[model samples]
Target: MFIRIDGKQVEVKKWDTVLSAARRAGIQIPSLCYHPALETAGACRVCIVEVFEKGWSERKQVTACEYKVQPDLEVYTRSESVLKTRRTTIDLLMARAPQNAALQALSKNVEYPQTIYPPVADAGDCVLCLLCTRACEQMGCNAISVSGRGDTRKIEPPYGANPDACIGCGACARICPTGCIALTETPATITIWGKVFERLHCVTCGAPMMSIAYRDYAVANRELPEDYYTQCQECKRKEVTARFAGLSMKVHHG
Candidate 1:
């Protein structure tokens, strides 16, 4: 497909979003809550762009992550209206998460000035992008979710108590842009939200693999083989190698 971005013509493939096209054209657009591995959420309005059709004189502002590129479309990644909207959005995000390093980096990218709005009181560092929850769901854990609405919103386990499904995989924490989720790992345990999960060790080599909860969770989801959890990676490799060696010997003798 062919499109015009900042008055420059660019070529892209089908199903490519404006963000992907901008990336291909070497244009930098700040975005959060958008991961290549996960779905396009458009939770953060930081990637707003102005778009005009080939025959249309009016341009409309839209989220770049969710807007697909079309032939003869004109896209402006840094239009004045887009910058003003981004500044407002960034300022609000900064007010909501003053200590968030990701927000700080975004502020620099958009040239956001010092926030005029007062910081929210008692607001945790979570930007509420739902990236963490989406990531957990994609990993087949579905252990965490957003609770409440508006000002009282928070990321927590369902039922507002200890999570019954958390496997301590730390995928949520790793995908979190604000780093609100805390995951502490030791040789024997992995802890999150005051829940301790015992890390399972290999039966053959006694090497640590992952938390028992994760193994159980995977087993419940049928993501692992019946005997897959019995050994660590190294031991599994050795067992496969030994079996192949024995098979080769039997074939030679026969």
Candidate 2:
């Protein structure tokens, strides 16, 4: 089938969407939610284009990603109608994700003139791009998915608890564009009275030790054998005391 995009003729397969045809013909269309490997949801509506039929019908806006090309169809990707719809769509997206760097950059290029929208509420660094959900499902983790519907929907781990399948690999945190995911690790420190206290794990016992206590008791300090660092807290204490007492007696006798 043949379609005309911006007055240029392009060939397309029977079921090819306008987006795929334009892309194959080297035309650029800005889109965020249309991943080639996934089903097109048309949720973002950023790829809308104007379709013109030869008769008295007015040009209509349709999402290029989901609009299948018909034989002899004429499409104007850069028409005033298409540009207006795209700019408005971008403005709405920016209103929802003002802090999103990608969205901000896109908005600048698209010339979304009006800025009267209210500030996004507690955005949580999520632009709702759906990348996390795609990763979870496609990567076999299924560790995360979008919960709720519409504006209330949010990405959540399984059952809202840390997924039992989570390997702590931090893939979700890394893929997140908004920095919303909070990955937990061992507690590291506490601040009190404007002073920061460091937490120390005993090399031998794997138990939490007070950094101040370890530093103050010199007699309790002794270097363990390289392999002894894995021993428990009680074992480390006994080893240190035994070695220190022996050394004290030898020095006194000498």
**Model 1 alpha-carbon drift over 4 Å, by segment:** 202-207, 229-254
lDDT of each: 0.84, 0.67
Error of 1 at 157 (Å): 1.3
TM-score of 2: 0.62
184 in model 2: Cα distance from truth in Å? 11
lDDT of 1 by residue, 17-60 (tens): 99999897898888888888999888888899999986776999
lDDT of 2 by residue, 1-254 (tens): 78899999999999899999999999988777677776777867888898876673688889999999888888888788788788988777777777777677667667764445775676555667776667556545566777866566677765677564433434455555555566443455433212234544555445644433223322233443433333446756677797887742111110
Whole-model lDDT, candidate 1?
Answer: 0.84
TM-score of 1: 0.85
Candidate 1 lDDT for residue 75: 91
Residue pairs with backbone atoms closer than 3 Å in model 1 (clashes)? none
Per-model C-alpha RMSD: 4.9, 15.1
Lowest lDDT sum, 10 consecutive residues, model 1, at: 245-254
- Count of clashes, each model: 0, 4
| TM-scores of all candidate predictions against the true structure | 0.85, 0.62
